[model samples]
Target: MVKVVQPAYGRVFQDDEGAAELAKVLWKETVAALKEAEAVTLANLARADRYVRAKVEFENLYPTAYQQGPVLKGEEGGEYFNYRWSACEKLNERMLKLEKAMFGEATVKAGREKPAAGKVAADEFLGPDNGIRQ
Candidate 1:
């Protein structure tokens, strides 16, 4: 089982098994999406990194709720609810940014390969013979 750092919600998962399973699923989906976009670069890779982080944080929110059980009449209930809500908000924000970067109007410019030496310029209308033909 993979071990992730305890989220701000604190240690929610009783064991690493659940977290590891979730992480694996997220990783596979992230990789597939990246491949489809042909965005295997370092910069785009960072987007996937953000997604994984956000997902793990979001998943921890569930375990937190489970551990707390029903929310009784107390400020603690409100606080716990607020914290989980904040986590959801943050995860949504990250996902939105990632989607925009992956499929938005932004264009990726690939590096141009230099033409080899001795290549004739296509604009050179005048041929090697140097003059207009009869």
Candidate 2:
């Protein structure tokens, strides 16, 4: 006879034996996966940040503006430009891949009414008050 009101979603789930069982199994696995994904995402972020900082230092020293290939005048002086461009490209690719994986899984999981335990519950979330629509 107990109903756990999901405050944010305005839905409710009965705190019954069946619900408890489902939560025990499904939620555990989902949370574990999310944790692993988060770790990977964090590592990627750190690596990207380090690379960007290094690139900035290289830019200051080399000063791509001084290269005459495109603006100043000759392709030989633009080697630093190529290096910086490629490094930035690689960092961006890594960031995009990590972000996509993290966000895609989260979006799919959000649509389900009964997500596993440790996952964000309706009552636990707060947003613009448009419910999940926002």
Write down the lDDT of every candidate, Cα atoms only.
0.62, 0.42
**Model 1 ranges with Cα > 4 A deviation:** 1-15, 62-81, 105-134
Best by lDDT: 1
> What is the C-alpha lDDT profile of model 1 across 1-134, one tens digit per residue?
22222232223333666766676577667767767767666666666667666777677775765555544346555423445555566777887788677556666798887767755466367667545466
The TM-scores of all predictions, comma-separated, are: 0.50, 0.24
Q: Ten consecutive residues with minimal summed lDDT in candidate 2?
A: 3-12
lDDT of 1 at 78: 48
RMSD of 1: 12.3
- Clash count for each candidate, listed in order shown: 0, 4
